[model samples]
Target: MAGIYLHIPFCKKACHYCDFHFSTSLKNKEPLLKALAQEIILRADEFKDKIVETIYFGGGTPSILAVDEIKNIIKMLRENYEVIQVPEITLEANPDDLTDDKIKELAQTEINRLSIGVQSFGEKELQMMNRAHNAQEVKQCLQTATQYFDNITIDLMYGIPGLSNQEWKQNIQQALDFGISHISSYALTVEEGTALADFIKKGKYPAVDESLAAQHFDILVELLTQSGFDHYEISNFGKPNAYSKHNTSYWLGKSYLGFGPSAHSFNGDIRSWNVANNTKYIKSLSENQLPSTQEILTIKDRYNEYIMTGLRTIWGVSLNKISKDFGLETSAFLEKQVEPFLANGTLVLKQNQLKTTQKGKFLADGIASELFWV
Candidate 1:
């Protein structure tokens, strides 16, 4: 099965810590949508033979568009691609944009899932992140959203400089209070070139503390797992059978087509990304051209990718699969490299899968990098 990702690269305002491609102005919104539709038709042949199980509307802010605009794009995708009869169509939305009318309108569409961007419910944290919504909006949106959709997920962030562990726990509890089925929580990382980075450089914002973030992460995992949510992926928690089908397909190395500016696509061997500039993306597609760059994955590249994604997931890395796919030499190298982690109780070999222990879950990325095939 395959998936489709459409990037909506327009936002009302820039978040202090955001580094994703997006425009603050809506000047090119019309042209961008047209280009996006054109892109769907342009790339239809690639996935003609594959059944599209998911269509994700990810973004700078997908909710920035009107309901009709989103519907038009979905209609275009259906006309061009062999989308399944009941695909898991998800739209990433901001809390402020999800008003009662908007939520009801979305419920009437083919979109079945809603990934709300409710990073934090704290007022100070909201202002610090330059989010448009306040705490009240979060509660209002979820109250209304839960009424309309069942397969809902909300994005939460921990590790804000002044956000204490207690506050972080409260944030998770607030989400649980709403009966959210899936949650994607992340630690706040200050990316270079973002406003948050500049603020820290000038002492305008406090630096992110690694120890505090780790503490918050521990709290997150313990609370969510106890609340009956599976920590299926390092950054994601889902109730049983409620895992994100689109993102799961991605981690499992399934083929997916991404349309619009700054989106990426993968088809097993080669990975490609569209240009980040909206104008350039639209102009290229106006001429019936795809503005993207691609790379052919080397055996080492594939193996390293498998290691990175595998270690972060509940499924873990399969030793037998690695042996069959990457040969005995690479498999042996991996086994030797992982011995240290296994000996330290950071990883365990269960059912031939190299799974992370609770102690090693937070450090999964670092451990995976050390075991990368050079």
Candidate 2:
């Protein structure tokens, strides 16, 4: 199966910690939407033989678009591609953009899921991050959104400087009170070139404490698991059968096509991404050409990716599949590399599957990196 992703590269405001490709200006919004539709039609042949089970509208901020604009994109996909009757169409939104009227309008369309970007529920934390929404808006939006969308997911951020454990616990409790099905929580990372990074460099903002982040992570895992949510991935918690189909498909290495500026696409072997510059993306699409670069995956590259993704999810890396796909020598090398971790109780071999123990879940990425074929 395959999935489709559309990246809306426009945001109303720039957050302090964000490094994703986006423009605060909407000068190119109209032309960009037209180009996105054209890109969809131009790339239809890639997924002609496959069925699209999920369509994700990721952002800068997808909720910035009007409902009709979203509908037009869906119409184009339906006409050009073999989409399933009830595909899981998700739109990533900000709490500020999701008004009562907006929520009602979205329910009328084919979009079935909403992934709200409610980073935190603390006003001081929100202001520190320069978020467009306040704590009240988060509450208002969730109260309205939960009434309309059952398959809703909200994002939360931990590891903010000066945000105490008590405040973080309150954030988790608030989200649980909303009764949403899925939660995507992430640590506050300081990406280079972002405002947060600049602040830290200038001593305007405090540096992130990794030890505190680890404590918050442990709290999150304990709380969510106690609340009957599955810690399906390192950063995701979901109710039974409520996992994100689009993201889960991506983690499983399923083929997907991404449209718009700075979007990435993958078939089984080759991965491609569009130019990050909006003007250049528009100019190339205007000339009926796809402005993207691609890389063909080597066997080693694929194996490493499998190991990385496998260890992060509930489904660990399969030894038998590794042997079948990468040959016995590669499998043997993996076995040898994983010996230390297995002996340290970080990983265990259950039914020929190398799965991480709870002790290693927080460090899954590091463990996967150690097992990578160099």
Candidate 3:
């Protein structure tokens, strides 16, 4: 099965720490939407025979669009692709954009999942991140959202410089109280060229505390697990039936087509990404060209990718699969490298799947990099 990702590169405002490709202008939105629809039709043949199981509308702020626009895009995809029945169609939305009327309209479409960006329920943290939604809006949006969507996931962030541990707990508690089925919590990092980075460079804001971040991550695992949520990925927790199918397919090395500006697509070997500039993207597409770059993955590149993606999830890396796909020598090399983490109790080999232990999860990226082939 394959999935599809459509990037909507427009946001109401830039977040303090965001690094994703997006524009603050709506001047080109109409053209961008048309280009995206054209892209869907143009790329339909790419994944022709594969069953489309998931379609994700992600971006700067997918919720910012009008309900009719979202419906039109979905309609276009359906006309062009063999989209599966009951596909996991998710739209990433900001809390401010979720109104009762919008939620009702969303329910009428084929979209079945809502991934709300409710970074924090604390007013102070929300303002610090320059988020448009207030604490009350998050509560209201989730309340209204649950009325229409059962497969709901909320995005959250921890490790804000001024956010306290108690506040962090409250964020998770809020998701639980709202009965949100999935939580995608991430540690706030100061990306270069972002407003937060500039503030830090000017001594106006302090750098994020790495130790505090790690402490919060530990708390996240303990609390979410106790709440009966699967700490499935390092940054994601889901109730038994709520795991994100689109993201899971990516981790499992499934092929997917990505449309619109800055979207990336992977076909198990070659990977490609569209241009980040919205104006250029629309111009190129208007000229009947897809503004994108492509790369053919070498064996080592594929192995490294597998290490990165597989190690970050509960499914982990399969020794036999690695041996069969990458050969015995490569598998032996990985086994030897993984021995230290295994002995340190940071990783465990269970049922031939090597997964990280709770204590080792915080350092997952480092461990995966260590196992990477040259």
Candidate 4:
């Protein structure tokens, strides 16, 4: 189908605002990678009839692995699945890990895209987030990575407590200066268990300002749009032909298999995720058992997922599909539900597709939740 996602659950250090499942310790790395490979082989039967179009290496820091380790995983995938001739293989990497030598070696692998985590170009922002990479490393990695790969996307964060609108613009400009084709920009959110949240609670750090974040988001969209980049998804921007195929598949509701601890997978109806604990995931897979829990989605669940994703993308929700799949009752209910939004200029209906207006872009998730079939 659309892709396979491998979660490399190891990071050099934890970012202050992240809540994703990852371990900073490398002690279980070898076992984890081995288990990751095993899990891929074990799940091959699940999608035997499907041809994979993309392979995404996500996570704690996929760049933390050596080139050979990365290669071995790709090798296992090749042995197990029917990957397309030129799959959109992506590696989520950090700046410090992508040395000149490392980039050279990665260029030789099947990986054709790099999604680098360069949270911000400002040293204060980087330090504030406790990101492993420094300002200089961000610049260095981009310059060197461009030399080797043309398809590159960088992650940028905005709305930090001390960051100003001007500094936010500068961060976007820095990415543009590198000729970066794709950008995944996000506002700094303090997840409940993250260090940032705890710090804010303890009065050691300031809380995130929603108005400030909205300002940053507006600037980002305006700047990137003027630079000839398409605002493909709410948090993603890309030049022509540079959008992330793997992630696009997700927004479009295509099935993909995720390997490694805390990874998720979905078929048309069933959604599953591996255990978040590294040791438990490895132990189960070692015993030839899948370490995952799954649920068969109900009609209401599917409709809600579509509404959540569709409104966030350039391609909005299709009323016709809703009618056909969930029947006219659901479609009519949705049409009725959207009356307030349509009248307020926050939504538009065109060719049977319900889309978010620019004013509603930042509030897509909220809008989707309100529209869900409760």
TM-score of each: 0.99, 0.99, 0.98, 0.99
With a 3 Å backbone cut-off (N, CA, C), the pairs that clash in candidate 1 are: none
Model 4, C-alpha of 113: deviation from truth (Å): 0.3
Write one digit per residue (lDDT tens) for candidate 2, span 1-374. 89999999999899999999999999999999988988998998999898999999998999999999999999999999999999999999999999999999999999999999999999999999999999999999999999999999999999999999999999999999999889999999999999999999999999999999999999999999999999999999999989999999988999999999999999989999999999999999999999899999999999999999999999889999999999999999999999999999999999999998988998899999999999
**lDDT per model, in order?**
0.95, 0.95, 0.92, 0.94
Which parts of model 3 are misplaced by more than 4 Å? Answer: none
- The residue pairs found clashing in candidate 2 are none
lDDT of 3 by residue, 265-355 (tens): 9888899999999999999999889899999999999999998999899999999999999999999999999999999998999988999
Taking the tens digit of each residue's C-alpha lDDT, what string does model 1 give over 1-374? 99999999999989999999999999999999989988988888898799999999999999989999999998898899888899999999999999999999999999899999999989999999999899999999999999999999999998788898889989999999999999999999999999999999999888999999899999999999999999999999999989999999999999999998999999999999999999999999999999999999999999999999999999999999999999999999999999999999989999899999999999999999999998
Clashing pairs in 3: none
Residues 1-374 of candidate 4 have per-residue lDDT tens digits of 66899999989999999999999999999898888888998899998999999999998899999999999998899899998889999999999999999999999999999999999999999898898989999999899999999999999988888899999999999999999999998988879988988999999998899999999999999999999999989999999889999999999999999999999999879999999999999999899999999999999999999999999999999998999999999998999999999999989999999999989999999999999999
Q: In candidate 1, where is summed lDDT lowest over 10 consecutive residues?
A: 158-167
Better of 2 and 4 by lDDT: 2
